[model samples]
Target: MNASLKLLPLAIGAALAVLPAAYAAQDNVQTLSNFKTTGNTKPAETVPQTGTRADALRENLKAIKLPPGFKIELYAVVPEARAMTIEPSTGVVFVGTRKDRVWQVTDRTKRRVADDVVQFASSVTFKVPNAVCFSPDGVLYIVEQNRVLAFPAAQFFGEGGPDVAAAVVVPQGKLIPTQFESFNHGARYCRVGPDKKLYIALGQPWNVPPKDKLAELDKNGLAGIIRMDQNGKNREVYAHGVRNSVGLDFNPKDKSLWFTDNQVDGMGDDIPPGELNHATKAGANYGFPWYGGGHVRTEEYKDQTPPAGVVFPMVEYAAHAADLGMSFYTGKMFPEKYQGGIFDAEHGSWNRTKPIGARIMFTPVKDDGSVGETEVFAEGWLTPNGEYMGRPVDVQQLQDGSLLVSDDYAGAIYRISYAK
Candidate 1:
């Protein structure tokens, strides 16, 4: 045997020793075995796109206000839709839900409306597969609560059957320490960066984690964003101190990372504003626990001095807006003013005295790369009586320059297009 080849076992053992205990060899082996099954004959579960529920969603579009020449229409019905990614080759939109299912929405006739909405890879049992994104080469990545799976050539295999070919990128309970997992703040967001690395947001699981938990949370990336190779190797935390960021996108211009952060709750109705942050480099900390949101000191750490070099948000939104998913508009279908702007979804507030932000906000990027003032691009989801008609979760831009907004509250995706 070659001299270097003789050391392979030693190298493997060294690496395994450093990994967390949750990544046990036995558990990973079992998870891999489950993913490599032969094609499943079980039919994919299809979501009904028509009927009373669909009609009610379409009617709500009339209440939404958009700029002149812009219109919103129901695109598809995807239950608990949170994050979305489109296959570049086929225009197939894969949407992730807060539940165990990830949906594949297809428009077969090239029409704007979807012809089919079915669960993708139905046989694989997922846990909160709320983050779905695609690589430049059409590889599908499903980032779950504590696992990440990859599907190569997903555009083709997705239509084959319920058991589409899959490979475990990050095994169950391996993305973060299993003990730190919580029911709240678990929904994640991921994006394939310009360097072709996979980036995932790791929401720290608490309204405000106790002081004793902060070190562990940051070390395991449960309170920050992490990145790794597409095959889930060489993983490292990209940003630190994020409370819970469900929305993030790369600025098409300078390639800086921008994301929205939901701040701590129970701080009253109108304080500690939500955040739209800009991350220009790795290892950047966006203060949490110490500074709740937008430099507002948290009650838990108001007396202690926060770590130096904490980055503040570029834009501080209204308190309790619950800003979630966002995307930079790269399509030419919109007017010149919106050429390189952002469309952010505010899921709205759950506990505020008066609910706010069940609509889309547009922020323009100036020529010098500064973010312009954000303005409301769509509204009326919150009714005159303050009831939520539909709460938007994510925004995805189609190839034709139109945009798709996913709403978990309404269980549907709405398309927005502009024409003069």
Candidate 2:
């Protein structure tokens, strides 16, 4: 048997022998690793187009299979909203768009409505704004292909319209530049860590590269989490070898950071699975091209072995799920069973022979922040014949204990709630 394959039976036996023990360990550590990135190329810029396709599709959202007395609703009309963030004080929601604009949606009268949609920020030439987030103090941070900009929360949404030109420039180092021909992941997602520092997700430039050329790998070198102070200073690598992580969230109770990574495509349908990881410490390397899921080896990283102290994912989802944004439920609106569960939006898949992952998934989370088995939360977005209605991109928990889901393909945001 091959040396790598030898590790599998052992790992599997270990997993099965002490499954409960493994769960105990997971509850304690709350981390995992090793994955790749996958996404469609950024769309080209075009004039703003209006539509009711998203509105029409909202009626089709299916109910999650849950206990009785729980209900979910279509919350708001946010066209083309993805990578969402909510301002705690005002309950105002902000989302980035593929049209190079950021939109703010407000909740009123138990309904979410677009109070005022403005071109909050713009990319000179890029097709989309990568991500957006609000700091604890209410500062709005927006990430473009090659730049990071911030505006005061109160000032941006105050009586006067936001002065986009007056926003503070955040130094993004060599990661983003004005002109770049190649080697840019450009899927920058950010969140505030337990330590109050900003953690940004930077993707690998290539899925799998030639083994001899390690430097090319470094271009995506900051493939994992990049930590920086609020001012974007003291930047350092929090972890390494992550391909691309679009969905990231910090557990409010344990203060641990969690993320969802889309694995590399073109691999056979079931060779490797999508991963859910936790950022445990600074400088930890999760196996990437080198190692995956404890024993799965890739051609590009054959000789390399998983380094000591490297972590693996807490749980694995179906291959080609295209898992994206993740958020932990910490609200009182839902049953206590869902208080700490994770809601992840699977953007669906393009590289698979069979369509998968067009809906949101739920994973039971322990008090210590480790995840349990994953179950389907919502479905029916994909037709039985494999045609897709919408692709979910992100999920966020609202101040009022509701959930917001962003669907980039249909350009709509749907709200999931529970009620007696």
Candidate 3:
């Protein structure tokens, strides 16, 4: 009868807790009372936010708070935009989503306002193609639910659209082992690291899986980040024990890995917090089932001993923030104080009693290259009445030193620029 239980994907929590494990694994997917995710169902009368009205959207932008001399503008109207990457040559921004399409926002006149917003590859059948990045050579890479793809001519030659027949890099069912596909936590966020290797995140499907599944999880490279050669050869696990990291970027200063993890939910309203994790090198494991968010132990794995030498998070944020896409600011547009900092998107909480974190946050890199605590950069999406006008899903910086923040809820991408 708990209010939060109604928001779960399956039956109420109390009812599921008493069910046998055999029945729980009938579909080979386990759902726990404490492991339920924020479901996708909305109220019957929930109006669709398609981001079609430009003038009305600009009026709402007046309320967002940013540091002085900085301004926000309506860049492009992209529905379901999750993570994005920019093509340096043409100034086209490629955006990915959990839906079946990838969007391209172009500024042909160099006016900063996007005049063209269209689907990149209308011919290809995309399934949750939600993360995108560009190589130094201008090749566009898309990481999806079940595979990885590359478009060598994505910028110049493929301007008309991708040729799906020749653009397959990592084929279908090869991203994961194929046995672990589920509707939950398969958001693939990826990029080409400074070392020129392609890094991809494969999230574990269960909320808090049983202890017996850890070895298989490791074997399948779920709950971890993996990297490989540009041709998808010699793929290896880079970091492990990460629970659903939808955002990741290399520190421009160090070229090492840093990411945002959506921690285990349903532990109460405010026990465990969202995490900004860092790994000095490959083969490091950030704590997951043993220590859910920070060091807060989940009720399921409180008794079992976690593997030793587990790495902890560097920066922590408010619980249920759903921190998704992030990038480090290496541009010259923002003030000197804002340089070399990290910008992240908190997609907001769904099941919490009081919803929080429909905002964009910033964290500065210290003098010694350490990460600092999070500070709100752009907010006002979640209104005073706990309703969402927009939910920021990702953040990207362009060649002109401005920033792009995508909101899947409002279905628009806003441009942030600095004048002074």
TM-score of 1: 0.92
Total clashes for model 2: 5
TM value for model 3: 0.86
Using lDDT, give the best candidate's number: 1
- TM-score-better candidate, 1 vs 3: 1
Compute each candidate's TM-score over C-alphas.
0.92, 0.80, 0.86
Candidate numbers, best TM-score first, in rank order: 1, 3, 2
Off by over 4 Å in 1: 1-40
Residue-by-residue lDDT tens digits, candidate 1, 253-326 = 88889999999899999988999999999999999989889989999999888888999999999999999999
Backbone collision count in every prediction? Answer: 0, 5, 0
**Better candidate by TM-score, 1 or 2:** 1
Cα lDDT tens digits, model 2, 15-122, are: 333334443233221111011111213332222323465346545666233346655555555667789988867787778865556776655454554434444422
What would you estimate as the lDDT of candidate 2? 0.65
lDDT by candidate, in order shown: 0.86, 0.65, 0.79
Rank by lDDT (best first): 1, 3, 2
- Give the C-alpha miss distance for residue 33 in model 3, angstroms: 46
Clashing pairs in 1: none
